[model samples]
Target: MDFSLSGLWHEMGLFARLVVIVMGIMSVTSLLVVGERLLVSFKGMSDSKVFASKLASLLADGPGRLDAAADTKFGKDIGYLGRTLRAGLVAYKGSVHGDKDLCFESVARALERQQARELAVLKRGHGWLATVGSTAPFVGLLGTTMGIITAFEKMAASGSGGLGTVSAGIAEALLTTAFGLLTAIPAVMAFNYLAGWVDARAVDISEASNEFLDLVARRLADGPSEEEEEGEESEAAA
Candidate 1:
């Protein structure tokens, strides 16, 4: 019997073939997920840098600038920071006329909620990657185990204990394990990389959120800006 990959494949039992197919699917899916996540992360980073620059200028003028700037078009697909800030801004605008403490608290809660949501979005495919990484080897091992059993059965049937009788089957079984490892290694690496990115982004989000809250606090302490007072008076007159 032949022992090359094609030969081994031909010699493989149905279960072994199935295991290989499953591993192939896992590898493809993992690659797709990794590619998608990397693209998103990179794009988000770029968008966020631009958004941050704009935000910094607006913030320099005071949080009141956000009231008018809120309606300004950033882009359709802003990054995590943009989305989170937008949420907080909306909350702040809505509650600005209410109690000062409540307004601050409302923005704080909105920022927190937006942070959680952004993290969740970033982690979308992480579970599948983790599952593939942790289980692919075991799945391959199962195929290997079954292949070994078949090899032994063949040896018994042929009434031959010689290595040649079972070597082919053993090799075929081991191929599944190799496939499993191949599928798992990339997944694990991708998962680790993605996790690090997520952690770093989380820190960015936290710091940005805190800075925003401080800005809000300072704006409140200094009293409402003339523009805000004018808006309020206009509303009262109407």
Candidate 2:
């Protein structure tokens, strides 16, 4: 009764083998998701930093610089901050010369919508990881139950029940259990880590939106620009 891996593999019945194959697929899918999320998280963070720095510089120059800033390559990137800021800016632009209240409301709605979309993107594939983590063990338990049933069946058939007759089935149960834990531990860890990253990004986007709105408020309070006032005066004189 060799308790080695190859020996156990050979002894696994059809049901046990099917369970192992399913677990292997789950493991591979979890790994791929983890890698993709990590890559996206890191790239988003880096691009957001660049966009933030550029936005700050433009904002410092004055609210008038926002249009140009929004048109920049950085603003068009797929990062959370860039997309959110661009959405708000586009909304503001459409209503800039009209009602200030409407402009602010539009910008706020745009920010909220962009934030939801970005968060949703960040959360993609997270559910599957959670499902794999929570259910893999139970799946393995099902296999173990089947293996135990087979073991007892063999004992009943042989009529001379001994350790040799049942060890293979017990080995299958233990191996499946071990593989389940192996697949689940990393999946749970990755899900937690990625969730935290998404939260942090959300906070950053919220703060950026607030800062942008504050600038807009200041611009509105200042009233119309000198050029607009001059043009109105010329029209009146004509």
Candidate 3:
């Protein structure tokens, strides 16, 4: 067959095409992962905002916060945080003016549970990102090696191997390696960005929880008061 465009297309070997296909599949998988994680991140931010607001509204005591928050739409996702805050409120209530040990313990435990739940959500998809980042270059390297092998084979066949025989194979081989890296970079970037965002949000949530708890404590504090009539009688007697 003449080495025209159509000839090249028809003659292009299976390995070159296979490399392309593999790269294509990797690209699609990485994109899908990025999309899913982005969606989750956005939804998580929304859920966090809503959870904070609802919990703040009913933060007077454990029972009140629980009664108010447990039935909300974001219930299960943030139930642990709500329960933790409630635990603190309950501990304080049970010993309104008692030692800080029990209240601190209850709140601390609840906060830890809340952190675990949120961390789990954030940890999702990182493994895929890591896999892509680590494996993409190797995929490219394999393609390059295959291409080099083809070039060498063609060289072997022709007693006097020409540049053309090896160039095409080398080009095709390197393309796969390049292709792998192209698919991997974006995935790595997305993973890093999303992971950092999740960490920041977790910190924000922790701080917000502490702030709300203190507010509840402030509202509960009481001071003794004297009557106006008693003050007036004392003044008159003097």
Which candidate has the top score in TM-score? 1
- For model 1, residues 180-238, the per-residue Cα lDDT tens digits are 99999999999999999999999999999999898888867777778779999999999
Could you say which candidate leads in lDDT? Answer: 1
Model 3: CA > 4 A from native: 1-19, 57-100, 213-238
Per-prediction TM-score? 0.95, 0.92, 0.71
Indicate the TM-score of model 1: 0.95
TM-score of model 2 relative to the true fold? 0.92
Quote the RMSD, in angstroms, for model 1.
1.5
lDDT of each: 0.90, 0.85, 0.64
How far off is residue 195 in model 3, in Å?
Answer: 1.7
lDDT (C-alpha) at residue 105 in model 2? 89
Residues 1-238, model 3: lDDT tens digits = 3345454435456876776677678778878888887887777666656666776666445433432343344445543344445454455445433444555455556666666776676678888877887787888788778878888988888765787777667666766677888978887887788778778867775776677555544433322113324666788999
What's the TM for model 3? 0.71
State how far residue 86 of model 3 sits from its true place (Å): 6.9
